[model samples]
Target: MILSTASSSQANAAFWRFLATRLLVSLLTLLAVSFMIYGLIELMPGDYAERELFRKYSGTGVTITQAEIDRVRADLGLDRPFLVRYGEWLWNVVTRLDFGPAFRVETSVNALIGDKFFYTFVLVVGAMLISYIVAIPVGIWVASRKSGIGDGVVTLLSYLGLALPNFAIALVLLMLNAFVFDLDVTGLVSQEFRDAPWSMAKFLDFLGHAYIPLLVLGWSTTAFQLQTMRGLMKDEMGKLYVTAAQARGFSGWPMLIKYPARHAVMPIVSTIGFDFSRSFNELPIVASILVLGELGQELLLAFLDADQNTAAGILVCITSVIIAANFLSDLLVAALDPRVRMRGGR
Candidate 1:
């Protein structure tokens, strides 16, 4: 009883220590990203309101005088020192999750991002789910088959997937639908449900419309996972322990699963951190091609429009998400592989 209690206590202490280390690292990473984003925003050519007003008045025979620009800048607090503005924005984020309003639209940053964020999150998660579901079994089968015809075909398909970018996939599908199928697979939902509130019909419409985008986003990831899993499993199978297991008369699926597959899964586990960090950044072109209005689209518009607060809010949100994912991934890897936990402790 005493040994069990001590062991549990020690494990709990180690887990908390590991968590603390990850939290500190995540916080520092977020701060560094925020600083870089703020500095870049400061270095941009003009404030959001100025450029927008120029667009609004430039061809209308109304001169946007320097006086008008200055007044607008003053009113928007754009003339404040960079550090001061950054501090205020940071405080607002910390205190109230308020990243400020869109300079032209006059909507809160969160309000502008809320629905789009959900869409992007769903897109990324759906892609990842599809990638893993297809990749793992196919990868294992190909690795086990090695030089068989099925393996060859799957290998060719994976290579093709890697060669084709998501945008190319989107373009090809779009053209095929346009020229051959007479199908309209361009957007997330039909025109009727575009602005309609959520309903059973809307949800079903979304499912119907979501498959193409999901395929565009997920295909490459699935291919990459397949290649990675195949290589790792192949390597693991060739190791001395696998040879020993074979010598012990465990020759087929049992040997593969009991000996090699468990070891091969670690790299895939570790990649979750990078994958989570990257999901939001990938497939922007795909999103644009499909008119999905995902977060990547919103971020691009925010940057082009010089909506610094909106852009900053997005950066913070993305960074926070990545950090949280990293933290979780670390714990997951540690749980799956004791080596990682030991290394972390050291």
Candidate 2:
């Protein structure tokens, strides 16, 4: 009983330590991202409003008074020093979860999210799901058949797919859909229900158009994952333990399917998380190429116009999401590897 209680106490202590570590890491991530984002926003040539207000006629542009610009800057908290502005923004975000309004768009940050969050979410999730579905089986076959015709074919395809850019691939797919299939995916809808209300049917209709974008985003990364999975599996299959198992007549699909695949999942999971994070940030380029209704669309416009608020909002959100992805990856790694606690994972 005493030993058991001691063990329980140790477990509890470790749990708290783990939680504290995660909390500290999360706080550090937030600070780093905040500082980096603020710095980058500061570095961008000229202020958003300043550029816009001056673009038309320069000194004689809007005839805007210095007092008005100062007032506007103060109201936007732009006049404050970087540190002070950060503190103020941090306080608002922590207390209110408010990210202010977009400079380029006719909506609040929250309102923009409301208008487009579902579409982005669907696009990301669908891409991830399809990628995983395609990667795993192909990875297994390539690994099991390492250096055989199956592996050769998969390798060729993976390389070819990786060589193509996501935007180009998406553009081609879109053109084919429009020209070949006579699919009117040109404007985020079919003509049949372009005027329909926001409902499940309409949402699905939007998703139908979204599929091309998802595939474009997913295909290259999926090939990368498959190659990694194949390599990891191939390495594991050549291990002494696996060789011994095979010698013992335990050689079959079971060994490949069960043991090697299980071991291969570690790298695959980590890679998948990394890929997913990248896909979110990259959607902007794809959005521009495909004319998809997503935050990426806003991001492109933000950059073109040098709209600080809009660009910063998208950057902050994207950075936060990617940080969360990394956090989840750490948790997963810790969960998977007992050595993490004993040796301290990086």
Candidate 3:
């Protein structure tokens, strides 16, 4: 009993250390991503002040003089050294949850992003859940019945999903809704509920409109995950351990679930963060096509308008989410696979 207790304590210590290390790595990654995003924005062709002035006076036939642009830059503190501005922005973000201001909109970045991030978060997370929930069972089934008609059908669908761009999917769905269903499927909320205060009716209306984008986003993700799970299961099923288990009178669902299925799930869990990040990377174009007022759409507009602060703020938020997802994936993998914990500890 004493030896068992010591062993348990050592395992606990190792697990905690693993978690701490994973967290430190995630923080460092987030910092590097943020700095790179800010640096890239700084390196862009024109400053926000120049773009804003041109946008404000372009069609009105008013010349935006260099002096006027310089004065506006000074007012917005764009005249400060890049490092100094980044330091202040980073400090505010870390200390007070401030993301600075949106240069073009003349509003706090936090306020501008208020509900957009929430909507995008829901869509991305929902898509991920849909992918995994569908992938795991179907993958196992297809792997067990390889080369069958059902498997062939699924393979065809998965290929099509992977082959088609997300925007193409969105456009096809839009056309289908327009020609056949005649349904209102664009945006996160119906026209009436778009500006309405949050209530049960408004919430339900939002969900009604959200499903189109959700399905559009989830389509390719599900296909990719399904293929991954199918491949892994097939590989695990052919492994020596599985064959050994079969020789020991194990077969059918009981044997498959206990051995190969359990093992196959580890890689799936480990790649959840990558899947999530990929989905977010594809989101901007998809969201724009769907007319969804998510952070993805805002991000594209920010870049086009030379609104660096808004773009930086949105990129930082997305990067942070990706890092957090990766951290969670590590915890989950460690929990499910003792080998991972042992390796990390060592």
Clashing pairs for model 2 are none
CA RMSD of each candidate after superposition: 2.5, 3.6, 2.2
Which is the leading candidate under lDDT? 3
Candidate 1 achieves a global lDDT of 0.81
Model 1 ranges off by over 4 Å: 1-12, 246-255
Tens digits of per-residue lDDT for model 3, 274-320: 99999998888888788888897788778877676688788888887
> Against the true structure, candidate 3 has what lDDT?
0.86
lDDT of 1 by residue, 138-198 (tens): 8877888859889889999999989998888899998998889998988788999978888
TM-score of each candidate? 0.90, 0.82, 0.92
Top TM-score model? 3
Q: Looking at model 2, how many pairs of residues clash?
A: 0
How should the candidates be ordered by lDDT, best one leading?
Answer: 3, 1, 2
Candidate 3 colliding pairs: none
Evaluation by lDDT, superior candidate among 1 and 2:
1
What's the CA error at residue 21 for candidate 2, in Å? 1.9
